[model samples]
Structures are given as C-alpha cells and as structure tokens.
Target chain A: EAEVAQSPRYKITEKSQAVAFWCDPISGHATLYWYRQILGQGPELLVQFQDESVVDDSQLPKDRFSAERLKGVDSTLKIQPAELGDSAMYLCASRPPGSGIGTGELFFGEGSRLTVL
Target chain B: SQKIEQNSEALNIQEGKTATLTCNYTNYSPAYLQWYRQDPGRGPVFLLLIRENEKEKRKERLKVTFDTTLKQSLFHITASQPADSATYLCALDKGSGNTPLVFGKGTRLSVIA
Candidate 1:
C-alpha cells in the first residue's frame, strides 16, 4: 500500500531558532494536510492544500509558521522562531481526489517530532 | 464554538474483552465521524468511519456507531489484545466538502494480556 512519507523523524532546537519538517503524500493524492499534535491532545489542523493551492489556514499561526506544497505532491512546514510550546508531533496526511472531504479517510505519515529547548 | 469530548482519558480492559470508547460533540452537526488509533510518538492511523445516515459500521473486530440525533459516536473493539493498547481518537467533518475534520482529545486504552 502506498504511504505518506515524512522526514526528520525527530528534531530538537533552541527556542527562537528555525525548524522545518517535510512530507510526501501518496501518489495521485490531491489534498494534503499538516496538523500539530500536542501531548495528550488530539491533532489540530494547521494547514490544508489542494493541488498546490492553500485551501484553509485559519488555524495556522502565520506570524511564525508557514507551509507550502509547491508541487502539490510534497509539502514543507516551517517555524521561523520556535517556542517551547511548539514542541509536538507534526503530522502529514493526504486524500485522493474526488473523495469527498467529509467521507474520505486520511492516510497519515509516521510524523516528525519536534522539541524546543 | 465547536467542541468534541471523549468519555475519559484512559481505560483498562482485560485481554479478549470488549473495549468501548465514547465521543460526543456539541455546537456542530457532523456529516461523518471517524475513528483513529495512535501509538505513542506516532501519527494517527484511520480505523473506521460512519456516516450520519448510517447507524453502524463494522470492520473485523472493530465496530463504530454514529448517532446524529444524540451527537455522539461509539467505538468498540472486541477480543482486544495487548497490541490494541493505544490512544483512540474521534474526528468529525461537517459534510461540506469545504471544511477540514476536527478531532477530539483521544481516549487511551490499555488492553492487558
């Protein structure tokens, strides 16, 4: 089965430093998502992309966080000045085209864990 | 504001027993509900989905039920094993192809052998 791939499985950085995480969705998937999972809490959506276009980013903290799916296939999420509260699991997920967002299931990667000191 | 709530933070069950987890939502009407499993330090894995029009859905030893009237969903795992121990999450989508799914803080289950 095709799976979403994520890099930098673990990352540690000082507060106020930069951090980045990458994700490659399953081939042919048109929709991609980036979510942040805090310890003991559910995953929260940070951004959503549809074929290289951003669909939703209301929850994203644009002042410090940014995400891009340049090719609509792989994506990158970056935090310019990391904060201690930013430490969490960064998850990437994808969905096939034509699958209704309300009904289709998400395929998630192993995730990139970040720790800010 | 939309809110999702799971029954508890943790649950303990013996091997071969059935484990039931609950999810409730308020201030929103979801078109579909989904269940996911997450091991420590790992991303969530989709397990099952039930639609608003559907009352029940089952896959092997896993079963899910959606009650739109009550605004709740129940996830059940039968004949559970130690490997089944993990955090289970419930997600909801408003059914409009426009919005993303929202998740609830998961319930961690410990299936002892």
Candidate 2:
C-alpha cells in the first residue's frame, strides 16, 4: 500500500529559530493537508492544498507559519521564529478519490515531531 | 459555530472485551463523520467513515454507527487487544465545498491484557 511520507521524524529547536518539515503524498493523490497535533489533543488543520492551489488556510498563523506545494506533488511547511507553543506533531495527509475534492477519506504520514524550548 | 466533542477521559478495558467510544456534535449538521486512531507521538490513521444517510458501517472487528438526529456517532472495537490502545478521534467536514474538517479532542483507550 502506498503511504504518505514525512521527513525528520523528530526535531528539536530553540525558540525564535526556523524549522521546515517535508511531506510526499501518495503518488496519485491530488489533495494534501498539513495538521498540528498538540499533546493529548486532536490534529488541527494548518493548511490544505488542492493540486498546487491553496483550498483553505484560514487557521494558519500567516505571521510566522507558511506552507507550499510548488509542484503539487510534494509539500513543505515552515515555521519562522518558532514559539514554545509550536512544539507538536506535524502530520501530512493525502486525499485520494475518483472525483474532484468534495468528500473523501485521508491517509496520514507518521508525522514530524517538533520540540521547541 | 460547530463543535465536536469526544470523551477526554481515558477508558480502560480488558483484553478480549468490547470497547465503546462516543463522539457528539452540536450547532451544525454534517454530511459524514469519520473515526481515526492515533498512537502517542504519531499521526491519526483513518479507521472508518459513516455518512449521514447511512445508519451504520463496519470494518472487521470495528463498527461505527451514526445518528444524525441525535447528532452523535459511536465507535466500537470488538474483542480488543492491548495493541488497540490509543487515542480515538472523531471528525466531521462541514457541508460547504472545500471546507476543512473539525476534530474532537479524542478519547484515550487502554486495553489491558
């Protein structure tokens, strides 16, 4: 089974620094999502992309966070000047479906864990 | 505004028994609901999804029931094992096109052998 891929399974950084996490979705998937999971909490959507175009980013804190999928295949999420609250598990997910982006299930990556001190 | 709520408390169950978790919502109607499992320090893995028009959906030992009138969904794992231990989350996507999903805090399950 094809799986979503994420890099740097664990990352430790000091506050005020910059960090980036990468993700490669399943080969044929057209939609990708980035989520942040706080300790003992559910995953929160950070950004979503539909074939190189942003579908939703209302929840992302644009001042310090940015995400991009330049070619619509792989994506990267960046946090500049990280804050203590930035410590969390960052997950990447892909949506695969026969139709265009209305409704479908998502497959998630193992996630990149960030620890900011 | 819509809200999803799952039990924040940890549920302890014995091996070979059934473990049931609850998810409730308010303020909006969803076209479908989904359940996911997450181990500590990991991302959520999709378990099952049930549509509002469907009353129930099952996959092997896992079963899910959606009650749109009640605005709640129930997840059940039968003959669970220690490996089944994890946090279970319930999510819903608002009906609007391209809208993102909303997730509950999740309920932690601990299956003791």
Candidate 3:
C-alpha cells in the first residue's frame, strides 16, 4: 500500500507572499498530477507530468504559479504573491507505469492546505 | 465541452440502508468513469471505476453501473454506516493517451446511526 507523500499538511500565509508545497509520488509511478480543490468544490487539475516532462499545464496560471519535477520523481508547486482566492487544498496524485495510460486508480496524498489572508 | 452532474447537494440515509449516488455527463463520451470518496479536509480516495463497455461492476458491498448510451454512471453502497459519510466525486477519462480525469463537484452523503 504505497502512497503519495505530501509535506506541511497545513500552511497559513498572507496575501502577496510566496508559498510552496512538496510531494513525492508512489515509487515506480511515472505520471504525477497537481490539482487544486476549493471549498465545497471538485478538484481541478493544475498541471500534469509524465516522467520528467510536462504533458499538460494549460490550466496553470503561469504568471504567479510554477511547478517542477526536476528528477521526474519528487515534485514541487509554488505560488508567488498569493491571493485570497488561492487558499485551497493542493492535492498530489500518481499513476503507475503499467496503469494503461490513464485508465486506472490514482493514488492521492493527504494534500497540503493553504490559507491566505 | 463536457459537464458532469451528481446528485443533490446532500443526501441523508439511515444506517444499514442502501445509498445510491448518481453521476450524469453530457457533451462527451468517456471510455471510463471513476468514483472517489473524500472526507473533510482530505484528498479523494479511489472507490471504483467502470468502463464504458462494461455494464456493471461490484466490489463487496459497493456496486457500480455504467450506461454508455445514457452517458451516466451509478454508484451504490449497501448497508452503509455512519463511517460512510463523506463527499463522493465522479470523474471521467476519455481513454486518450495521457489524458487527465475531469471531476464533478461531488455529492455529500450523511449516514445517520
């Protein structure tokens, strides 16, 4: 029962500050994803990485948000000059290599909570 | 554009009863649909996945049915308990290579003992 690992379960910051969250996907997983979940809302994908390469990031607000998986194993997501609306849960998920190309269960981390005031 | 709609904002069920959640979609055909459960302040945990070619799938007390023609999927939990209370989300992946799942807002269920 390997799981995706996330750090700083909770974080509190002020607007205009920078915040970062780290995640380690399940071992042997090749696909990693970062999603944002607003209160009482479904999680939305922000970016997706296949190994060390980014496959999709059309939804990410590049002006203030950036994400990277330097070694294609662990990943980091950062938001600079945080806004009040940016307060939400950041979720990390991973898919194993043999999961049949997006048709399998996703292992999710407990998530990192961000509260911007 | 694709849209997924679940049940009402919330559902109230008694313990030892069956709880059925609905997930309907429009504007796109999905190759597979998945259900996940989320407790308060936590991430979603996968429950089950049903493929378009499959009519029904079951796991212990949990059952799922997919209707490709109607573009809908149904999730069921039998003899549910108070511990079953949470928000249930339904997501879909079109089966394209490397495509991501699109999630719905989710329906909250409260099982009373």
Kindly report the docking quality category of candidate 1: medium
Error of 2 at A69 (Å): 0.7
lDDT tens digits, residue span B1-113, model 1: 99999999999999999999999999998888999999998889999988899999999999999988889999999999999999999999876774677999999999998
Worst 10 residues of 3 chain A by lDDT: A96-105
lDDT of 2 by residue, B1-113 (tens): 87888965699999999999999999978887889998887788888888888899999999999998899899999999999999999999654555566889999999999
lDDT of 1: 0.93
For model 2, fnat equals 0.50
Error of 2 at A99 (Å): 5.4
Off by over 4 Å in 1: none
lDDT of 3 at A75: 99
lDDT, residue B27, model 1: 99
TM-score computed on alpha carbons, candidate 2: 0.95
DockQ of 3: 0.69
Q: What lDDT tens digits, residue by residue, belong to model 3 across residues B2-105?
A: 78999777999999999999999999788889999999988899999888889999999899999988888999999999999999999998877767889999
Q: Rank the candidates by DockQ, best first.
A: 1, 3, 2
Indicate whether candidate 1 or candidate 2 has the larger DockQ.
1
lDDT of 3 by residue, A21-106 (tens): 99999999999999999988899999999999999999999999999999999999999989999999999999877676546788
Residue ranges of candidate 3 with Cα displaced over 4 Å: none
